[model samples]
Target: MKCFEKLVRDFITSSLPASMNPLQFAYRHNRSTDDAIAHLLHTTLTHLDKGRDLSWSRHTNSLAKKARQCLYHLRRQRDFRLPSKVLQNFYTCTIESILTGNITAWFGNSTKQDRQALQRVVHSADQGQEDCEGPHPSQQ
Candidate 1:
């Protein structure tokens, strides 16, 4: 858990804005469970884009930060809490590792346009994975 926390924390600290707060965002989705994660990210980004002084700013937390919040939302109560830093560490250590260093290209580019292009590549890479993996024979 410590390693997990460390990786996620680092990722959050660096990937997010230096002056941004992670706990003032909220996300909602028409479909629960499957779309929850993406919804959270979208909401957070939107909140940040709207600035911190928005009326809704006081009522939210970053999706990663919320993982440690009330757990009874969709199911059983969550007994453990993980902070933004820890969550960043976990993501970096786990899924970030899977990026095999491509994440550097995704975020560390010299220009905003370059970064955006890299983001498209990442998106395409993600979509490609779904096609590549397909459905299991058992499901057919």
Candidate 2:
């Protein structure tokens, strides 16, 4: 078994690009005494756990930053007021696209905290739009 593991490691070292770091993840219920089985890489990989869970905080934070920038730019335009429909369209194209990008790939595997953070970003964007438009006729 050790010989096979060594061969596999040697093959990987020879085949993979130098820029890529080789990482080993042990997903065992019981801890193993063998250090080679779960050796840590020199540089830790970001946004991935041993259980293959993705940390989506970076992605969500990027989306929020982009959305905020778009909102600020839209609000700063003083030449003419953008119609509500146009504003909504812009938000959907710029912000919603970022939020939903690759969602199918990661959403199912995301932790509850990650999902809640994403939800907050969407909710805040919605609230910001309402605030920008002022009170609706029905509410007033």
Clashes of each: 16, 0
Candidate 1, residues 36-81, lDDT tens digits: the string is 5555655765676575532222122222124322122212111134
Per-residue lDDT for 56 in model 2? 61
Segments of candidate 1 deviating more than 4 angstroms = 1-109, 134-140
Please state the error at residue 123 of candidate 2 in Å: 2.0
lDDT of each: 0.40, 0.62
Candidate 2: tens digits of C-alpha lDDT, residues 64-91: 6776666665554312566767767877
Top candidate when judged by TM-score against the true structure = 2
Candidate 2 vs. true structure, TM-score: 0.50
